[model samples]
Target: MGAEEVLTVISNVGIWRLLKAVGRSRQRLGLDAQRRRLVRSIVAHEERRRVDSEAHP
Candidate 1:
Protein backbone atom coordinates (compact mmCIF):
# COMPACT_ATOMS: atom_id res chain seq x y z
CA MET A 1 0.00 0.00 0.00
CA GLY A 2 0.96 3.67 -0.29
CA ALA A 3 2.28 5.70 2.63
CA GLU A 4 -0.97 7.23 3.80
CA GLU A 5 -2.79 3.92 3.53
CA VAL A 6 -0.07 2.23 5.51
CA LEU A 7 -0.11 4.88 8.24
CA THR A 8 -3.89 4.77 8.39
CA VAL A 9 -3.88 1.03 8.82
CA ILE A 10 -1.27 1.25 11.54
CA SER A 11 -3.13 3.94 13.44
CA ASN A 12 -6.53 2.27 13.15
CA VAL A 13 -5.58 -1.35 13.79
CA GLY A 14 -2.41 -1.19 15.92
CA ILE A 15 0.82 -3.05 15.17
CA TRP A 16 -0.29 -6.67 15.41
CA ARG A 17 -3.19 -6.35 13.01
CA LEU A 18 -1.12 -4.18 10.70
CA LEU A 19 1.48 -6.94 10.55
CA LYS A 20 -1.21 -9.44 9.72
CA ALA A 21 -2.69 -7.12 7.12
CA VAL A 22 0.71 -6.68 5.56
CA GLY A 23 1.05 -10.43 5.23
CA ARG A 24 -2.33 -10.62 3.56
CA SER A 25 -1.66 -7.70 1.23
CA ARG A 26 1.95 -8.45 0.31
CA GLN A 27 1.17 -9.29 -3.28
CA ARG A 28 -1.46 -6.60 -3.71
CA LEU A 29 0.44 -3.77 -2.07
CA GLY A 30 3.93 -4.26 -3.39
CA LEU A 31 5.26 -2.20 -0.52
CA ASP A 32 8.89 -1.31 -0.91
CA ALA A 33 11.70 -2.25 1.46
CA GLN A 34 11.68 1.07 3.31
CA ARG A 35 7.99 0.80 4.07
CA ARG A 36 8.41 -2.73 5.35
CA ARG A 37 11.18 -1.58 7.66
CA LEU A 38 8.99 1.22 8.93
CA VAL A 39 6.18 -1.19 9.67
CA ARG A 40 8.58 -3.50 11.49
CA SER A 41 9.90 -0.63 13.58
CA ILE A 42 6.42 0.36 14.60
CA VAL A 43 5.58 -3.22 15.48
CA ALA A 44 8.70 -3.59 17.56
CA HIS A 45 8.05 -0.37 19.40
CA GLU A 46 4.49 -1.41 20.13
CA GLU A 47 5.60 -4.79 21.36
CA ARG A 48 8.07 -3.19 23.72
CA ARG A 49 5.39 -0.97 25.12
CA ARG A 50 3.13 -3.95 25.63
CA VAL A 51 5.79 -5.77 27.57
CA ASP A 52 6.64 -2.72 29.64
CA SER A 53 3.01 -2.15 30.54
CA GLU A 54 2.46 -5.75 31.48
CA ALA A 55 5.50 -5.77 33.72
CA HIS A 56 4.53 -2.50 35.40
CA PRO A 57 0.91 -3.42 35.92
Candidate 2:
Protein backbone atom coordinates (compact mmCIF):
# COMPACT_ATOMS: atom_id res chain seq x y z
CA MET A 1 0.00 0.00 0.00
CA GLY A 2 1.01 3.60 -0.47
CA ALA A 3 2.09 5.79 2.42
CA GLU A 4 -1.27 7.52 2.37
CA GLU A 5 -3.16 4.28 2.62
CA VAL A 6 -1.06 3.09 5.52
CA LEU A 7 -1.49 6.37 7.33
CA THR A 8 -5.24 6.28 6.85
CA VAL A 9 -5.52 2.64 7.88
CA ILE A 10 -3.55 3.44 11.05
CA SER A 11 -5.69 6.53 11.73
CA ASN A 12 -2.68 8.81 11.29
CA VAL A 13 -1.81 8.57 14.98
CA GLY A 14 1.91 9.26 15.32
CA ILE A 15 4.66 11.80 15.75
CA TRP A 16 5.08 14.80 13.49
CA ARG A 17 8.43 13.38 12.37
CA LEU A 18 6.85 10.34 10.77
CA LEU A 19 4.18 12.29 8.93
CA LYS A 20 6.81 14.73 7.71
CA ALA A 21 8.96 11.90 6.48
CA VAL A 22 6.08 10.34 4.57
CA GLY A 23 5.31 13.74 3.07
CA ARG A 24 8.90 14.12 1.95
CA SER A 25 8.88 10.70 0.38
CA ARG A 26 5.66 11.44 -1.44
CA GLN A 27 7.09 14.71 -2.67
CA ARG A 28 10.09 12.87 -4.07
CA LEU A 29 7.59 10.61 -5.77
CA GLY A 30 5.98 13.65 -7.52
CA LEU A 31 2.81 13.67 -5.45
CA ASP A 32 3.21 17.36 -4.61
CA ALA A 33 3.01 18.53 -8.22
CA GLN A 34 -0.12 16.51 -8.90
CA ARG A 35 -1.82 17.96 -5.83
CA ARG A 36 -0.79 21.51 -6.68
CA ARG A 37 -2.22 21.30 -10.18
CA LEU A 38 -5.41 19.69 -8.96
CA VAL A 39 -5.90 22.43 -6.38
CA ARG A 40 -5.23 25.19 -8.90
CA SER A 41 -7.70 23.69 -11.37
CA ILE A 42 -10.38 23.34 -8.71
CA VAL A 43 -9.89 26.92 -7.58
CA ALA A 44 -10.11 28.21 -11.12
CA HIS A 45 -13.27 26.21 -11.78
CA GLU A 46 -14.87 27.50 -8.60
CA GLU A 47 -14.02 31.09 -9.47
CA ARG A 48 -15.58 30.72 -12.88
CA ARG A 49 -18.72 29.21 -11.44
CA ARG A 50 -19.04 32.03 -8.91
CA VAL A 51 -18.61 34.67 -11.60
CA ASP A 52 -21.20 33.03 -13.83
CA SER A 53 -23.72 32.80 -11.00
CA GLU A 54 -23.21 36.41 -10.06
CA ALA A 55 -23.61 37.54 -13.66
CA HIS A 56 -26.90 35.64 -14.08
CA PRO A 57 -28.48 36.24 -10.65
Candidate 3:
Protein backbone atom coordinates (compact mmCIF):
# COMPACT_ATOMS: atom_id res chain seq x y z
CA MET A 1 0.00 0.00 0.00
CA GLY A 2 0.99 3.64 -0.55
CA ALA A 3 2.07 6.09 2.13
CA GLU A 4 -1.31 7.79 2.44
CA GLU A 5 -3.19 4.53 2.77
CA VAL A 6 -0.58 3.19 5.14
CA LEU A 7 -0.92 6.30 7.25
CA THR A 8 -4.69 5.83 7.24
CA VAL A 9 -4.32 2.24 8.35
CA ILE A 10 -1.90 3.29 11.08
CA SER A 11 -4.36 5.90 12.29
CA ASN A 12 -7.20 3.40 12.30
CA VAL A 13 -5.27 0.60 13.95
CA GLY A 14 -3.35 2.77 16.41
CA ILE A 15 0.42 2.98 16.13
CA TRP A 16 1.05 0.87 19.22
CA ARG A 17 -1.19 -1.90 17.92
CA LEU A 18 0.37 -1.77 14.49
CA LEU A 19 3.84 -1.99 16.00
CA LYS A 20 2.71 -4.95 18.08
CA ALA A 21 1.35 -6.61 14.99
CA VAL A 22 4.62 -6.07 13.19
CA GLY A 23 6.55 -7.56 16.08
CA ARG A 24 4.22 -10.54 16.21
CA SER A 25 4.34 -10.99 12.48
CA ARG A 26 8.07 -11.37 12.67
CA GLN A 27 7.62 -14.27 15.04
CA ARG A 28 5.31 -16.08 12.65
CA LEU A 29 6.11 -17.85 9.40
CA GLY A 30 5.62 -16.37 5.91
CA LEU A 31 6.51 -12.89 6.98
CA ASP A 32 5.93 -10.23 4.32
CA ALA A 33 9.15 -8.28 3.98
CA GLN A 34 7.91 -6.01 1.21
CA ARG A 35 4.94 -4.80 3.24
CA ARG A 36 7.13 -4.28 6.26
CA ARG A 37 9.62 -2.30 4.21
CA LEU A 38 6.84 -0.19 2.80
CA VAL A 39 5.58 0.56 6.28
CA ARG A 40 9.06 1.43 7.46
CA SER A 41 9.68 3.70 4.51
CA ILE A 42 6.35 5.41 4.94
CA VAL A 43 6.97 5.93 8.63
CA ALA A 44 10.36 7.43 7.85
CA HIS A 45 8.83 9.65 5.20
CA GLU A 46 6.16 10.91 7.59
CA GLU A 47 8.79 11.56 10.23
CA ARG A 48 10.85 13.56 7.77
CA ARG A 49 7.81 15.48 6.60
CA ARG A 50 6.80 16.33 10.12
CA VAL A 51 10.28 17.53 10.96
CA ASP A 52 10.51 19.57 7.78
CA SER A 53 7.16 21.24 8.35
CA GLU A 54 7.98 22.08 11.92
CA ALA A 55 11.39 23.43 11.00
CA HIS A 56 9.99 25.65 8.27
CA PRO A 57 6.99 26.79 10.23
Candidate 4:
Protein backbone atom coordinates (compact mmCIF):
# COMPACT_ATOMS: atom_id res chain seq x y z
CA MET A 1 0.00 0.00 0.00
CA GLY A 2 0.98 3.60 -0.51
CA ALA A 3 1.84 6.18 2.13
CA GLU A 4 -1.63 7.66 1.85
CA GLU A 5 -3.24 4.32 2.56
CA VAL A 6 -1.02 3.83 5.57
CA LEU A 7 -1.96 7.25 6.90
CA THR A 8 -5.64 6.47 6.39
CA VAL A 9 -5.27 3.29 8.41
CA ILE A 10 -3.56 5.24 11.20
CA SER A 11 -6.39 7.74 11.29
CA ASN A 12 -8.92 4.91 11.47
CA VAL A 13 -7.05 3.53 14.48
CA GLY A 14 -7.73 6.63 16.68
CA ILE A 15 -5.13 9.12 15.63
CA TRP A 16 -7.03 11.77 17.54
CA ARG A 17 -6.52 9.79 20.72
CA LEU A 18 -2.85 9.59 19.93
CA LEU A 19 -2.74 13.33 19.34
CA LYS A 20 -4.37 13.95 22.67
CA ALA A 21 -1.82 11.73 24.33
CA VAL A 22 0.94 13.70 22.66
CA GLY A 23 -0.61 16.93 23.79
CA ARG A 24 -0.73 15.69 27.36
CA SER A 25 2.88 14.65 27.20
CA ARG A 26 3.84 17.99 25.72
CA GLN A 27 2.10 19.80 28.52
CA ARG A 28 3.85 17.70 31.08
CA LEU A 29 7.20 18.43 29.44
CA GLY A 30 6.47 22.15 28.83
CA LEU A 31 6.88 21.73 25.09
CA ASP A 32 3.88 23.75 23.99
CA ALA A 33 5.59 25.48 21.09
CA GLN A 34 7.07 22.27 19.77
CA ARG A 35 3.75 20.49 19.99
CA ARG A 36 1.87 23.27 18.24
CA ARG A 37 4.45 23.43 15.50
CA LEU A 38 4.37 19.71 15.03
CA VAL A 39 0.59 19.68 14.75
CA ARG A 40 0.58 22.57 12.29
CA SER A 41 3.25 20.99 10.13
CA ILE A 42 1.41 17.71 10.04
CA VAL A 43 -1.82 19.44 9.03
CA ALA A 44 -0.16 21.50 6.31
CA HIS A 45 1.71 18.54 4.91
CA GLU A 46 -1.40 16.38 4.85
CA GLU A 47 -3.42 19.10 3.18
CA ARG A 48 -0.80 19.57 0.50
CA ARG A 49 -0.59 15.84 -0.14
CA ARG A 50 -4.37 15.52 -0.41
CA VAL A 51 -4.63 18.42 -2.82
CA ASP A 52 -1.82 17.15 -4.97
CA SER A 53 -3.30 13.67 -5.11
CA GLU A 54 -6.72 15.00 -6.07
CA ALA A 55 -5.30 17.26 -8.75
CA HIS A 56 -3.25 14.48 -10.25
CA PRO A 57 -5.90 11.79 -10.04
Candidate 5:
Protein backbone atom coordinates (compact mmCIF):
# COMPACT_ATOMS: atom_id res chain seq x y z
CA MET A 1 0.00 0.00 0.00
CA GLY A 2 1.05 3.58 -0.56
CA ALA A 3 1.48 6.26 2.10
CA GLU A 4 -2.12 7.45 1.85
CA GLU A 5 -3.47 3.97 2.30
CA VAL A 6 -1.20 3.38 5.26
CA LEU A 7 -2.26 6.67 6.81
CA THR A 8 -5.95 5.91 6.24
CA VAL A 9 -5.58 2.52 7.88
CA ILE A 10 -3.72 4.00 10.80
CA SER A 11 -6.33 6.71 11.24
CA ASN A 12 -9.18 4.22 11.11
CA VAL A 13 -7.59 1.75 13.51
CA GLY A 14 -5.81 4.13 15.81
CA ILE A 15 -2.06 4.39 16.04
CA TRP A 16 -1.83 3.13 19.61
CA ARG A 17 -3.60 -0.14 18.78
CA LEU A 18 -1.45 -0.57 15.71
CA LEU A 19 1.64 0.00 17.80
CA LYS A 20 0.51 -2.59 20.32
CA ALA A 21 -0.16 -5.09 17.57
CA VAL A 22 3.26 -4.44 16.09
CA GLY A 23 4.87 -4.85 19.47
CA ARG A 24 3.11 -8.12 20.18
CA SER A 25 3.81 -9.57 16.75
CA ARG A 26 7.57 -9.28 17.08
CA GLN A 27 7.62 -6.79 14.20
CA ARG A 28 6.83 -9.37 11.55
CA LEU A 29 4.46 -6.78 10.14
CA GLY A 30 7.46 -5.04 8.60
CA LEU A 31 6.23 -1.63 9.72
CA ASP A 32 9.65 -0.13 9.20
CA ALA A 33 9.72 -1.32 5.62
CA GLN A 34 6.24 0.01 5.14
CA ARG A 35 7.39 3.30 6.63
CA ARG A 36 10.32 3.41 4.28
CA ARG A 37 7.95 2.74 1.44
CA LEU A 38 5.75 5.57 2.60
CA VAL A 39 8.65 7.96 2.86
CA ARG A 40 9.92 7.07 -0.57
CA SER A 41 6.46 7.43 -2.03
CA ILE A 42 6.05 10.86 -0.45
CA VAL A 43 9.45 12.01 -1.63
CA ALA A 44 8.78 10.74 -5.11
CA HIS A 45 5.45 12.50 -5.20
CA GLU A 46 6.96 15.73 -4.00
CA GLU A 47 9.77 15.50 -6.53
CA ARG A 48 7.21 15.23 -9.31
CA ARG A 49 5.60 18.53 -8.30
CA ARG A 50 6.70 22.06 -9.20
CA VAL A 51 9.47 23.09 -6.86
CA ASP A 52 9.04 26.74 -7.81
CA SER A 53 5.68 26.98 -6.04
CA GLU A 54 7.34 26.90 -2.64
CA ALA A 55 9.90 29.52 -3.57
CA HIS A 56 7.29 32.18 -4.36
CA PRO A 57 5.51 32.02 -1.00
Candidate 6:
Protein backbone atom coordinates (compact mmCIF):
# COMPACT_ATOMS: atom_id res chain seq x y z
CA MET A 1 0.00 0.00 0.00
CA GLY A 2 -0.56 3.48 -0.24
CA ALA A 3 -0.90 6.19 2.38
CA GLU A 4 -4.65 6.26 1.90
CA GLU A 5 -4.88 2.51 2.31
CA VAL A 6 -2.85 2.65 5.50
CA LEU A 7 -5.10 5.40 6.81
CA THR A 8 -8.13 3.32 5.87
CA VAL A 9 -6.79 0.40 7.89
CA ILE A 10 -6.25 2.67 10.84
CA SER A 11 -9.80 3.98 10.60
CA ASN A 12 -11.18 0.50 10.20
CA VAL A 13 -9.44 -0.49 13.41
CA GLY A 14 -11.32 2.37 15.15
CA ILE A 15 -9.69 5.77 15.11
CA TRP A 16 -11.59 6.96 18.18
CA ARG A 17 -10.26 4.12 20.29
CA LEU A 18 -6.74 4.89 19.15
CA LEU A 19 -7.17 8.56 19.89
CA LYS A 20 -8.69 7.83 23.25
CA ALA A 21 -5.70 5.69 24.18
CA VAL A 22 -3.34 8.49 23.17
CA GLY A 23 -5.40 11.05 25.02
CA ARG A 24 -5.58 8.95 28.14
CA SER A 25 -1.90 8.22 28.19
CA ARG A 26 -1.04 11.85 27.63
CA GLN A 27 -3.42 12.95 30.36
CA ARG A 28 -1.81 10.50 32.74
CA LEU A 29 1.57 11.98 31.86
CA GLY A 30 0.32 15.60 32.26
CA LEU A 31 0.03 16.51 28.60
CA ASP A 32 -3.76 16.62 28.41
CA ALA A 33 -4.05 20.06 26.87
CA GLN A 34 -1.38 19.52 24.26
CA ARG A 35 -2.79 16.13 23.39
CA ARG A 36 -6.24 17.54 22.80
CA ARG A 37 -4.85 20.25 20.55
CA LEU A 38 -2.78 17.75 18.64
CA VAL A 39 -5.76 15.49 18.07
CA ARG A 40 -7.89 18.40 16.89
CA SER A 41 -5.22 19.59 14.52
CA ILE A 42 -4.79 16.12 13.07
CA VAL A 43 -8.54 15.73 12.59
CA ALA A 44 -8.88 19.10 10.92
CA HIS A 45 -5.96 18.45 8.61
CA GLU A 46 -7.35 15.05 7.64
CA GLU A 47 -10.75 16.55 6.94
CA ARG A 48 -9.26 19.17 4.68
CA ARG A 49 -7.21 16.59 2.83
CA ARG A 50 -10.26 14.40 2.30
CA VAL A 51 -12.31 17.30 1.01
CA ASP A 52 -9.61 18.45 -1.33
CA SER A 53 -9.09 14.98 -2.75
CA GLU A 54 -12.79 14.48 -3.35
CA ALA A 55 -13.20 17.85 -4.97
CA HIS A 56 -10.30 17.33 -7.33
CA PRO A 57 -11.14 13.75 -8.23
> Each prediction's Cα RMSD?
14.1, 8.2, 14.3, 13.9, 12.0, 13.8
- Considering TM-score, which of the candidate structures 2 and 5 is the better prediction for this target? 2
lDDT measured at residue 47 in model 1 versus the true structure, 0 to 100: 100
Pick by lDDT: 4 or 5, better one:
4
TM for every model, in the order presented, reads 0.46, 0.51, 0.46, 0.48, 0.41, 0.48
**Which 10-residue window of candidate 5 scores lowest in summed lDDT?**
48-57
Q: Is candidate 1 or candidate 4 better by lDDT?
A: 4
Flag regions of model 3 displaced more than 4 Å: 1-31
What would the per-residue lDDT of candidate 6 be over residues 1-57, giving only the tens digit for each residue?
A: 999999999897797777778788775666767788899999999999999999999
Shift in Å, residue 51, candidate 2? 0.3
lDDT of 1 at 25: 65
Best-matching candidate per TM-score: 2
Q: Better model by lDDT, 2 or 4?
A: 4
Write candidate 5's Cα lDDT for 1-57 as tens digits. 999999998797797687777686656557677889999999988876757567665
Q: In model 4, which range of ten residues has the least summed lDDT?
A: 25-34
Candidate-wise lDDT, in order: 0.83, 0.83, 0.82, 0.86, 0.79, 0.86
Residue range 1-57, candidate 1, lDDT tens digits: 899999998787886777777696674465576689899999999999999999999
- Please give the distance, in angstroms, between residue 20's alpha carbon in candidate 6 and its true position after superposition: 22
For model 3, residues 1-57, the per-residue Cα lDDT tens digits are: 899999998797897687778787664433577678889999999999999999999
Model 4 segments more than 4 A misplaced = 1-30
- Candidate 2 least-lDDT 10 residues: 9-18
Candidate 2 C-alpha lDDT tens digits along 1-57: 999999886775555557777787776568778888899999999999999999999
lDDT of 5: 0.79
